[model samples]
Target: MKKKHNDHFLFYSESKTKNRITINGQEKQHAIAVLRVEDGEHIQITDGQGNLFVCEVESVLKSSIECNIVESWSVKRITPDVTIALGLTDRAHFESAIESLTALGVKKIIPVIFEHCRKPWWDKWRRYEERFKLKMISSMKQCLYPYIPELVYPTILKEVLEEDKTHMIVADPNGSTLKSEIRDKQTPVTCIIGPPGGFSATEISEFNRTKVVYVKLTPNRLRTELAATVLCAQIIGHTL
Candidate 1:
């Protein structure tokens, strides 16, 4: 098996100023003992929020590695701000969703609960949190960007729809095609996706009541993971 964090490795280092950072804990051990990184070698680092730093390793101490920032820059976040809310039904597919969407520069992910959602889904979601966060860190590093996408889970569908400030979109095979023409330049957007079994008729009615713009990704229905990933990528493409 491939080693963990062989390339594009990233970790959380809180720096009030971006000029300096200390990599401690197991990460420090990985660099000093395992990676055997030498002084004067440059490496990448991030604050987990948009600021990326390229630094030269000044020294490797027993407890931590110290580095001096060589270059500092910020990546521009995507426009028509996007958040993804979905019901996760498959463990492997859900991990794929997180990996793909985060690399695409999505800012937020909300794991929502709906009427068609089964009890088994909840159990799987709870068990996957640790792995999910690790996947986020990996994706954050692989993408070579700074900001870590926010992951919110166990959120209720009704409560999410009730957010008045953010404009909403729903993924349904029945709705009209979504394109740049349908994009709203003014408000932040949140796209909602349902389970593989699909939401009930009453749930669709509630979506309409909440004024969600329904869009169809494909003529045929898609799995929840594919639907959410595709919709997020499409919106991000338009914004970029």
Candidate 2:
């Protein structure tokens, strides 16, 4: 069986049994219309939950594609399980950050509503949740990654900081360098990136009171999205 190097080469589906998997909607359309795969052709599929199924096309329907699983295996989640608590920014920036973060294999993402955050954006976060989800999915497939980072609902920065967690790192301009802080760390980490206009004075004081390590990604300031992608890449490098 010749393999096709099309975007639909790897499909995603959550509806699967022991031996069969059914893909519908956009995934089906990509397979049937874009890739134009025929029955009996083998393709790769992921459930976006760390499982990859090597399936052979069984039937193509008007609205769905059926395949028989010939082989399957699970991919382990990235170690040190890094979660990024990014302060909410504009829709374009937030979406771009998640796309880069997802491709970098972030385990989870939490949209934070910091004191300086744009209140209007957070107030209507739910309305754009689906669009954000689709962006993450597209990034995952583009990278051929097996898992989609868990996208948590928007939460206030104060509440996020209050959560009982260890190994918390916050991005700050006056903080210790990234190299110095993350060295020799061997535990799950949650990195926080402040939104535009930076964290407020009150928020800075809140950080001072909490047990969080502040890391300076660079000598100069970075936009919220770049800071997040850079931070995530730095952590991933350290983990490796």
Best by TM-score: 2
Q: Taking the tens digit of each residue's C-alpha lDDT, what string does model 1 give over 77-189?
A: 76666788878666677788888778877788888777777755555566778788778777877787676789976777888888774678899787777783354655788
Q: How many clashing residue pairs are found in candidate 2?
A: 0
| Runs off by more than 4 Å, candidate 2 | 1-8, 183-186
Query: In the order shown, what is each candidate's alpha-carbon RMSD?
Result: 4.5, 1.9
* Prediction 1 TM-score vs. true: 0.84
**How many angstroms is residue 212 displaced in model 1 relative to the true structure, after the best TM-score fit?**
0.7
- Model 2 C-alpha RMSD to native: 1.9
- Summarize candidate 2's per-residue lDDT along 60-131 as a digit string, tens digits: 888888999988999877777889999888888999999999999999999988877775666777798878
| Model 1 C-alpha RMSD to native | 4.5
